[model samples]
Structure formats: C-alpha cells, structure tokens
Target: MIEANGFSLIGIYGGTFDPVHYGHLRVAEELVEVLQLDHLRFLPAHHPRLRNAPVVASHHRVAMLRQAIHGNVRFSMDERELKRPGETYSVESLRELRQAYGEHETLALCFILGADAFVKLPDWYCWRELFELCHLVVVNRPGHALLSDPSCLPLALRNICQERWAAHADALKKISSGLVYVAPTTLLNISSTRIRTLMASGKSARYLLPERVLDYINMHNFYAGGK
Candidate 1:
C-alpha cells in the first residue's frame, strides 16, 4: 500500500519458512536497500508444489515470521498464499495482487529467491506470465556454484540464459515486459535447513537467527525432533 517516486516496490519473499531465520532477514534487508523497495512482504506458501519434504504447519510458520520482523516498519506479513486452499503458484498470486492494487497504480512487484531456485525457473507453473506481473530477483547462495555447463539446460532455458548474461540490467528493466531477470548479490551460507539440523542435534543456532525468533522456536518446541 506504500508508494515511492510514483512507483511502489513490493518485494515478496515467499517460502515454507518452517522457521524464519537470519538468512531470510538479511536478503530482505539487502533487496529493500539495493533495489529501493518501498515495502516487503514475507509470504509463506500454503502448499508448495515442488517440495517433497513435509512442511511445518502454516500457522506456526506465519507466527514465526511475524515475530522475526516485528520491529521493522518496512516489513509486513501476507497470509494470502498460505490461506489459499490448493497448490501455490506465483502467477496466480501476482494476478490477485494486481487486481487488488489496480494495474495503473505505478507499482512494481518483485519476488526474492535464491540462486538455487533460479535454475529451476522453467519448471514453475506459468513462469513466463509471472514476469509480466512482477520481477524475479535471484540472490546467490554462498558456496552454491553456478552450472558451468549450459549444454545440460533445456533448449528454451539455455536461450533464456544467453539473454540473461548478455544484458542483465536491460533484462531487469524488461521484467514487466515479460522477460525474467537474474539479480546477483553477496551469498550467505545460512539456511533454515542447517539451522534445524543444529537444533535437532542439541547444538546452539545462536547467531544464525534473530534472538527473539530463536526464543519463539524454543518455546514452541519446533525443529527439536519431537523433543
């Protein structure tokens, strides 16, 4: 609902968020600062189609996110995706948001994702149409190497890769014109997966997440392997 320079930059950070952690907060902060975003929303997917592992309950995830970003004025939580009944798709969410905000509102929406998700963009539902509604900002993950061999990519994806590497800035500008973009940033090695692993092993996940978030997780007995 906020606007800046006749344009509102709404950054969507969507994930299972089994538990919100420092890596998630760091990326959101970086995107807001670097991209000049007006506001950022932490969206927790209700049913992520691609995830094979069982996710924690949606309500718990949402609560954790709310706690993590409590004092940040620019950050807010949107449970729309988590409330949806079926499979969650970016295109569908974009359409709904556009309707709510109106098309001519001078708003620019961007979805923040890790580099690991970037390579699998082709497999997403209606991914091409998604770009028309919002920009995809792909942040690099620490220690995760990019594919050196482009030959292994699907022909369509390989072509897209060429376009991306050719003119990244131009591609980003063309995001609203139905072209995908890759945004590169400093990668942090922290991840919820690693954090959870540490907690289950009776180790401290101290600096890996916000102190309040860690307290909340401990209180709720989350990721403690049923302890």
Candidate 2:
C-alpha cells in the first residue's frame, strides 16, 4: 500500500468488466493518480445485484482482465466477488476488507464509481453502511452531470450525502471512511457493450481495448454468435 499522511489508500474499483476496455482502464488510471491510491483492485462481480449476469464466463472474464491490467502495478484483480456464490454485494466485500485489515490499521478504502451509479445509491444493498466502510469517489461519466447540484441526486441519497461531501480529494487521506469526493477523469468514448457488439458482428474492435485482451477474446471466440 502507498503510504501518505500516515495512512494507506486502497481503491476498490467494482464492475462487470465483461471485456475490459480502454474506458474502464483510463478511468481507473486517472483515479489512482487523483486519489493517490497505493493500488487499485478491480473487483469483478460474478452476478451484480442491479444488473444481469455477465455475457462471458467467469474464468474467461477473469483471464481477459488479468491480461488487460498485466503491467500496471497500481492495478490488480480481486477474485472475492467472482468466487463468492450468489449475487455480489458491495457491502459484503468492503466488510471483508475492513475485517481483514482489523480495526487499528491505518488503512483507507476508496470505492471508485461513476456519477450515474452514485445517483442510484439507494438501490444498492446496505448502501448506507458503505459510507462507514469506505470513502466514495464519484467520477463524472460522459453523459452524466456533476452531483454539485443537490437536485441531481434522488431525495433519499441527496439527504444522506448532504454532509458527506468532501471539499477535495485530499480529504480522503484525512479520514478512513464516510466522505464523498467527485473526480474529473478523461472521458474516453470506448465502452464494453460497443466492443461486444462489434465482435458479435465479426467487426474489428481493435484500439477500444488492450491488444492482449483483444487477442484473448479472438482466440476463445468470445461474445461471437451472440455468446
């Protein structure tokens, strides 16, 4: 873990990553630098609570992710959600991390997510407890607007986050959990859905994702024939 201000910061980036693409990588990379994260864990969900199961198999998805983040020391995969049975819940994984670190460790967990996801916070399982478990780093997506306007958030979430907003990213280092920080990252147009569509139609998806991951997908013929 990277030490800063007497604390270790670890970023937990959770997503389906059906086929890891440049969009996901660029955002994570920016967050790592913005948050001064020691390392960021890509927590791929086996079965997300709010969305349908991934189109690709768990093993294949995991393999692609490994290749996609191969040389990035600040990025690594966390197989906890993939190995856990049943639908994946953010609360459970964060709890496990906290327990593993113990109550006395000088560690900070930052949950990196997009603005779109943050607005739907109440729909998540044990959403409020998330604040007690880790700080939230909400990044602006291509189409989503900033949360600066209180009206942008649902009434419930807005009220809960009213006092949780941090003035800046550095505030996360001062507190272990229970703070919200909005980050501005490069808005890469790449998306996994578009890449999958191209692959299914026997079209080229080069440059949208890493060559290593694209090569793996081609070798296995994944997402083709409608998967």
Candidate 3:
C-alpha cells in the first residue's frame, strides 16, 4: 500500500450525461460530503466507446450541464474528453489527470463511478493501469447488484476488487496506487434513457431533470419522438 500523506482529494465524476439530472447532481453532492473532497469535476464524454452516442449534440450537452451545475462553486466541468478526438476512454482522462496532479504527494485523485459502471471495469481501456493513476470511489446506484463475494466476479475483476477494496474513505486517503471504496449514496431512480423516452413521448420530465436542463431540452425540441 502506498503511503497516504493527507493529500487534497479531487473527485472525478464522468458520464455521457445525456442530460444532467438530480440523479447525477445528488450523488456528487453526497460524495463530496462523504469523502470530504476538495473539489469534484463533472466530465462529459464526447464519444463514449461502451455505449451509444448521445442523441444531443456535444455543444448543447455541455451547455445543459453547465446550466445544471451553475451556482455550485465546488462543481466544475472538464472538457478534456469532450475536446479529444476518437472515442472517450476513462483511462485516457485519468492519465492526463495523473500527469497534472501526480507531483503532489499530498493529493488523492479519485474517480467516482456507479456500481453498474464499476462492475464492467474489466472491459474499459487500460483498466488495470487505472488503479495506478487514481483511487475509485464506487457509489451504489439503483438497478445494479453489488457482488459481495469476489469469486462470483470475473477473474480480473475479482482479483482487483478483493485486493483494493477499502472500507473507509480514510483507507483511500492513506494510499495512492490501489484503493476502491464503495459509497452508499442517495437512491435517485432516474436515468438518461428514461428521461429521453419520456420527453419523446411528450411527457414532462419535470422533477427527474433540473428546471434549466428541462428548459433547454424544451427550447431545442430534442428527443421529440426520435427513434
């Protein structure tokens, strides 16, 4: 285990964020509180590799995200993935972050992810090298099962999960290379898929999305029966 030097924690929250909603915002908020993070960056992927491309245009998606996260001082947007060519991968972004922040012995660069995403870590690009760059803070989300036993997971995933699992945020604070902490976050049962479908059906996605984001979507008439 690498030594923890009581470093400043910078949380990374990345997603396609087809539309930023309370599900995304609330999770980030609780994580900042639970981890006592110094800052949290909301990264929107331009071209995600594992999933279908977002229906909304890149500029519009970024605009909605910016409006959604507007007044929060600690929350900020990182457009590295958005600006990069080719499909966006988490490891690429993390590598850039490591290069930028690795010099500080007293800095913990953490990447926050959902349990659904974390379970599929084996399929991600340079996933093994991921631990070397930053610690993973996995937040539990609805509709995903958390495998309690390591043996039940894939060989690579089982090995990593068993070896790096951390019981507390302090455990992550004390190390650099390998630490995975599972966080119990607020269960907001909202998804971009559902949001899109609802809007396409001409239904108001009022509380599921932020007022500003809803307004943007309405103004653009996006997802209006798009198949």
Give the runs in model 3 whose Cα sits over 4 Å from its true position: 1-5, 225-227
lDDT values, one for every candidate: 0.73, 0.88, 0.85
TM-score of each: 0.85, 0.94, 0.94
By lDDT, the best candidate is 2
Worst 10 residues of 3 by lDDT: 1-10
Model 2 lDDT vs. the true structure? 0.88
In model 1, the worst 10-residue window by lDDT is 166-175
Per-residue error (Å), model 3, residue 2: 11
- For residues 1-227, write the lDDT of model 3, one tens digit per residue: 33345667899999988988899999999989988889999989998888898998888999999999999999999999988888999999988988887577778788998888888889998899888888988877788856566565678898776778887787767766578888878888999989998988877789998888888888888889422
Model 3, backbone clash pairs (residues 3+ apart or across chains), number: 2
Q: Clash pairs of candidate 3? A: 4-174, 7-106
Write one digit per residue (lDDT tens) for candidate 2, span 49-75. 898889998888999999999989888
Candidate 2, position 209, lDDT: 91
- As a TM-score, model 1 comes out at 0.85
Error of 3 at 127 (Å): 0.5
